[model samples]
Target: MRHTDDKELIRLLRLSDYAAFEELHHRYWLKLHKLAYRKIGDRQDTYDLVQELFIEIWEKRGTLNFGEELPGWLQKRLWFKLSGFFRKRGFNGKHQENFRQYLENQGFDKCFDPAELREVNACYEDLLAAINKTIEEMPNRMREVFILHRRQQHTVDEISDKLNLSPKTVRNQLDRAIARLRRSTEAYDATALEILFIVWLIF
Candidate 1:
């Protein structure tokens, strides 16, 4: 079983062979766990995600077409799971703390005056909208690299591996993406620009 290839394992899996399923899980669990932990940054959540991924694979064994690249197929599913996790935990705890600290450093008091708070909220919303538009307008590969690296917190090497590109190419894409975003935000005021920087950093 240890030496068996993925296609055979998958074929047995579709027939509900427990040993084949266990073998597949053994082969991929560590790699999947590491990737999940890197993207999620939570030990328990990473464990749960990896567990759920195996469960899903087992459940969908009959229908999933893994082709000749089982590793890639598993990784693509993990990426989708990670995306769903982030969406469900939108503006997560760390992000909220970062935002709060940014406001404090900019001299906003704990008890924000209602009107001032409203104005700040509006400005933040506008900045987000503009930044999203700019990202949307970027070239397809560049946008994917940027989102994976910055928004999804993936490292350059991770992005390179996932996208099947060289590390240098991934870095180049990120650099160009950042430069384009800066140009798009140039019309913003100093405070708005600062806010945009914070948003990029925390995300």
Candidate 2:
């Protein structure tokens, strides 16, 4: 069986040809959705974005110029859609511009460095284990309160309400837990892994 040319498939799609559109979808759906998913992160939002983009293609097929460059056209549309999503979430201008630059210059499909990522992951795990050991040595209520409030993203007020402690107690536990984490993590250099761990603790 002969594979269809992507440009030809797009041309047919613009001519209201559903068969060619289906072939195009089969050829590019996974790649496009993977790109979108990495940017969007949420599973449901990824699905919705991909579905919406294709629905838009069909809905606007009549106005599309068949000779258009498929990759550029598709990516431009996707980026605009993604930007609108980001804007809705309150991304500042600089953040949006940087994201656009990254996608355009660095190439979205090739963002991750496998070996470096592995080292970062290993360092992160080590930091976690050290922090866990420190926390485990803490007295009972302190450890529980620290983990529940700090590590689990609960607000001090919520932690206090849930544990029947004062908000001041919750904050104190968090400060102590973070100080302990800082001591355990300080042995590492300021690698991305260490930086991430420090930021996590401080935040």
By lDDT, who's the top model here?
A: 1
lDDT tens readout by residue for model 2, 1-203: 02778777877787789998777667667777877765555678778887888888888888865445776557556655554454354333443443344333323325432223222333444454565567768778888887675446576788888999999988888778667767777885434334333233222
Q: TM-score of model 1 relative to the true fold?
A: 0.51
Give the best candidate by TM-score: 1
Error of 1 at 165 (Å): 15
- Lowest-sum lDDT 10-residue window in model 2: 112-121
> What are the runs in model 1 whose C-alpha is more than 4 Å off?
94-203
RMSD (Cα, Å) of model 2: 17.3
**What residue pairs are clashing in model 1?**
none
lDDT of 1 by residue, 1-203 (tens): 99998888988999999999999999999998987665456788889989998998889888988867898678767756654564465445543454455445434536442122222322444455566677779999999998786667687899999999999999899889878877777776534434444343334
TM-score per candidate: 0.51, 0.43
